[model samples]
Target: MTEFANPGVGTFAAWDYVVFASIFVISSGIGVFFAIKERKNASSRAFLVGGRQMVCGPVALSLTASFMSAVTVLGCPSEVYCHGASFILFCLAFSFVIIFTAEIFLPVFYRSGITSTYEYLELRFNRVVRVAATIIYILQTILYTGVVVYAPALALNQVTGFNLWGSVFATGIVCTFYCTLGGLKAVVWTDAFQMVVMLLGFLTVLIQGTIELGGRGNMWKIAWNGQRLNIFDFAVDPLRRHTFWTLTVGGTFTWLGIYGVNQSTIQRCISCKSERHAKIALYLNLLGLWVIIVCAVFSGLVMYAFYINCDPWTAGFISTSDQLMPYFVMEILGHLPGLPGLFVACAFSGTLSTVAASINALATVTYEDFVKQCFPNVSDKMSTWISKSLCIVFGIACTSMAVAASLMGGIIQAALSIHGMCGGPMLGLFSLGILFPSANWIGAIGGLAFGVTLSFWPAIGGFIYPASASKTLPLHLSTNGCLPLNISDLLSTQLLNFTSQERERSILAENWYSLSYLYYSPLGCLGSLITGLLISRISGPKHTTIVRPTLIRPVSDLFCFWTDKGRKDNKEKTPSDNDRIIRASAEKELNDVCIQESRKIPSIYIPEQCTHINVLCVKETYF
Candidate 1:
């Protein structure tokens, strides 16, 4: 009955199924091939870090996979549908974060020569700091991957009329199978393929929807008329959503958590051959992010244009607007053979890539930080096998969690809140390890616990005990329904709960829900830093020692010392006269600088004596 549907077929044609099957089979095969190779070159370091030779494409792909999980793919559109232009600003903080990682975090990590980035915490701080950080990351990734995988399964259930379990089961079997088989190598390569598929599937929907909506201009016009095109609301209020300052600062920290501290991202960089290549890989990741974000934003507009007059949620056709994109794809692109298959495959790929990457990274951390640290004599083969086994265990746990968790919240908000809860503290711990030399294990651990508790409080209501009457502010609405002074209280219980009919109607009034996602990271980092310092000061003990200035030198110095430490005898340095003479000569040579000044006058016009005089002046002043 639909204009887009074909006459001969009742639902999807055979070719569409074939196309979908072929893509899945091919992508799976590619993963299997890599798995075989990984098994062949099996070693603890190789399994954990691909022997440190990952190229930009694989690194970029894995980073993209881990970064742009299904939560992102599905949630960005949902945010666009609900908040209009604000989500664009919400997502822009990533650009600056990527820049920070490229210049600051990547160089330090690549130079450290460690398999897990958290090991740097051990080297810089202590075992307790490393363990605490690794534990939080593992916990966050499990929850994060669970939600990510769950969202797409829910989307599949809505569009195809399959049971949610069937969708979950199908996705889990495939993702778990490949990830357990391929290790990090398979995860990275498959992620590259998934990124391509994810972009294509969304763009297909975007193009089809755009065409159906009449044109790109018409789409923007509809959004503009609806007041969804407003990006800047120049109100200097802290409670206001999408402010420039919030986006720049809060957004920066949130991203710093992901790129600078999170293993899911940093592992890819650590896998590269050298820090230079790692930096290159990070920039390429940013460039790809720029393209991917543009595509995602366009897809959002396309959805707006397609559903402008007759919102699907209003008609009771789809349970939620998150279902809007999937419904659009099936209704519009189902007729095109292989396209639906490609689309689903793309969706599955994104979910699987993230799940696999998270599990592998967690497994690596568990083995190194917990297992090996506890049992120092474990053989390389046993450690590697233990990590592989843990990967299987983690995959099973994530799958179980995915099925158990009922629908939570919008993909973007849920992802952000989850990240915010754990990421802020993790970022703080790493920052302390890398930047603050005085941070001891007790301080690091205390700061981490405090940061986690503080960040977790807002997410799961007040921490320890509920806030007292004095601490809690009751909501009073203006005539316009806008609670001007504090919206955090209003948002507390109802964070990201916008699909309800009453809630949607409330959003139409002037009292729109607006909160900054950026503040989560810095708040967490600050929480960790302050708490750690306080704890360290209080728990001053004989065992706690300051890091030597030599040890706290730049990354280059660390590498130089690490590479040559064995050659330098630890015995007392009996400096000979020749040794002192050589040191003096080296110091003088280091300080030497040649200053040059050239006379512009023609040979006939300039005197040789004047040229020599100017040269002496230049040398005396500049050098």
Candidate 2:
């Protein structure tokens, strides 16, 4: 039998190069085509939101691709392999995420008709809140984009001998080019194509691996007997990594922050032709996310079963768990000329989709919130050019950040920690706006500042002073029957030593730094919400008495208790209050008329219809 060694540089064949190169060429071609197609009407709105004429199918696929970054592609399988299938339980949270996002957050942003999600903060609170939220989002996206790009590049470097930086630049530049020139339309379409490629590649590896492991039944039996099929770890311990509580309850808040208020997702939702279509896209995205995650989980089980008698980690074939997926691909499909290349293409596809979405979203929020506010009179043509330029600039910044991420210990942990830090605070601010009507701007600003500080403290501390040992649970493995005698000896020497006192810290240190990262989003969100409520109560009520129904939760309409209380309050109003109520009723009437008209009209009929209706209603009310 032949001995196995770690794959070195130049491990990938020429056909593999062809497959990888094709992705770049096709992605760039799509960008150029869209750039030329929309050249005549290159307005900021068109570029940033695809003219708000996007369909549900492509938008849904784009959302799925954007959310399923390289971290999911490379890290999910590794997670399953290392800690069993408890990670799969997180899939349970997707439905809740979709429902909450659609029912609560989508209507608010869709009704507001804002280009940037951060704009909601400005409308509900003050400019200070808007600017703060934008900055936080920008930081989060930049950091997260780097980690997304880095994950696949690191895997490629390990399996194919490709330079990590080379892979990073290649994916980053291609994504930026398409996103810059093609705008949101190009980004969404390419993302749809990439998602298809990713699934094809993943399934190819999974099917081939399962067959080679003596079919699915044997594979499952081996994995189950090895304790790799533990799907439900119902432990309530927050300190334990993958429990039912962490995966379900904690995952709900994590995904809520991701799908609910993140600019990338909000942009996709608003880009749809109507709120109905956006909801369809969100549900479709949920389905797609589930498919990709299931594929990853099964691929992990296949890898574990294949390597049962030949542990790669014990044999020193790969340095990190993230490398396991790519390593398994090369080992199983290396002989099938183009398959390895397909796997590399899949990884790059995920990275490109994520980075492209982020660059477009970043360019969008930057242009709309900061640049356009200063230069509101800039022509649409000039605005489009400026937005494209911002895409390129942020693309370079993200690539540099990707370089920094390469030095980090774990891709999934680093990416999620960044998300929790920024996304949590941003979600908190929006939650206060949507769920709590009395939360003022002063409260929002103060709560956001405090929440950000609280999240950053733990994240930075954990990274700087990590535990001496990792906290991952072990999976059963044996190498006694391996062909190579040396591999068997290596496995024997590395006897299972799960006893490590790595996390035995003081109570204070444990509470602060050892807080499970899963709870970061919830904690930060609750921190912001509680703080905002307290501060708002202390500062007393705001001078303005009006409450926009669209800006708050729609639960008032469903609960008769709330509706009855609202009616009672309305009856107690003074003459001035009655006049204001009459104006508000007129505005609502105008909105209803506009909605009815919009349904009958073509797509071209609604350009800032909400804004126009507000203007007409105000002019007719008091004049």
Candidate 3:
């Protein structure tokens, strides 16, 4: 066994284990309670979406906890420590994404009343398109959840001397059990409890660190003087990472894909009793996101303040900046007995909430989109059982992937790359369906395939041939207080040589790989959208039938104002009259196709007004 030089500073005591164990016990108990309560009604819908009766508050908190994850809790502080505060601008972009998601994406999914978000693809395009989108989402969630599971394990390993694999398996098995037993109800309630623990732990560190550092004023002064208070970097270079444009513009598309189109966020929203309540939950989620961001950022500032003089990196206490947060926690809270355990519990909670959410969402899309469609005769009880089994299977898969992820470098970048790789293509498919009525299944598939290929090329290349592009920040840190003169001289010389080495590559390779990871999602979305649109125009419109109004956003209709004057004049008609003309055209085409091809087209009733329509307004909804 590896021994710590100072047990109090680097190892967990008996009380610490007690506090951490209590969290697992309580979380598992909640699952048992819900499993017993809902045992009689074990339908697929109830298992997946909680019977559409989840309240606004807990669901909102659950969404927040899921999105925050261990990635945000641990990664954000490290980001601030290493890169500066430019990342805080993501909050603004996230707010815009929330508004867009609420007004555009949520209404469509909630109004359609679909079990899986990808079902909209089948309705708007084809079954092939739906399956393609579902596969992409599953791949993305698995890759991401693995990284989420690995983050806490890696951090705990550094401070608590616990085996990394032990942490990973413990977290994975516990999360899988509760999610499999109680389903979404257990996941949401446990997430709410975990969210509280997360906040309390963060606030505890912030308040305690501030006092130790002589109050907030001194902490801010020290951080600002050391050049760690980087807020707005207005640089306009796309290749330069973490600038204003990257965080705001690039971040908007990234977050839109995450919150707007991802099934995890959509599942929580649709679980609510009404669209109104879901909207309320979404807004509450925005508030929670901001709070979490602030806490993470401030924690970074606090870490900087505490280490302003005695730099941990130079002193050789830690190997990477990612380990800095846990190191700081153990250093400051070790003497307080259960405090270290509480902090570990907090990190574990983040990992658990996120992994549980992902596993549950993955099972949902798997069973609803694939298994049920493939095995149409499966009963509801059997289907629910399949979903539960799937939850366990995916949880195990994620745990295995977590072992692989441990060998990877930079948790934040790895997680975001995986998310962008899949999220972009999935978002593109939805955007094509909702924004462009002319897009066909051929175009959707082609676009997604091409987009995914482009996104993954850079990711795989970077992983295989990892190269560092930027220089480390020149923050104020001195070894005068912690290191002897001779050792300090050697350390400074080694750092100087490392920084001064030449990074040489061909111009083509440099440009290709130099594209900031932040732009990956936006590029993928744009590439897929443009490709789909072009292919659709080339292939001509396949669906001449009346497009469902709920599938089309009203904002997209505003493009009608910018059409050529001649076309607009010829098409001048009231909105209701325009709807009638479109319907008549669709009817004519349907009759002609039916006669020519000798095939029957399903008929459905629709309202004259778009605004008054709901899921009930149309029957035979799927083509």
- Computed on alpha carbons, the lDDT of every model, listed in order, comes to 0.65, 0.79, 0.78
Candidate closer to the true structure by TM-score (higher is better), 2 or 3: 3
lDDT per residue (tens digit) for residues 1-623 in model 3: 12113223557889989999998999999999999999998798899999999989999999999988888878888777766666678789889999989977887788676879988888777788888888878878888888899877887797679898888999999999999999999999999999998998898889889989989999889778767776777888766667788889888888899999999899999899888899999999999999998999999889888877666755666766777788888889888889988988888888999999999999999998989889988887998899999999999988888877776677877788787777877788788777665567788888988888877777676666444434334344664555433245655666666555424555544566666777888878888988987777676644434455556553334333223542333222222212422366655764554344323322222323222222122211322
When 2 and 3 are scored with lDDT, the better candidate is 2
Clashes of each: 4, 0, 0
Model 2 has an lDDT value of: 0.79
- Which residue segments of model 1 deviate by more than 4 Å? 1-11, 236-241, 462-518, 537-623
Best by lDDT: 2
Clashing pairs for model 2 are: none
1-623, model 2: which lDDT tens digit per residue?
A: 23565443236788988998999999999999999999998699999999889999999999999989889889988888877887787788988999999978987788677889998887777788899899889989998998898877887787678998888898889999999999999999999999999999999999899889889999889888989887887787676666788888878888888899999999999988788899999999999999999999999899888888777765567778889888888888888888888988898899999999999999999998999999989998899999999999999999999877877667877777788887887788898788766567788888898888877777777675553234443665565554445564443433333123343555654556766777788778888888987887676654222345556662322332234444444222112212322365655654465455533221111112234443343323212
Between candidates 1 and 3, the one scoring higher on TM-score is 3
Range of the 10 consecutive residues with the lowest summed lDDT in candidate 1? 600-609
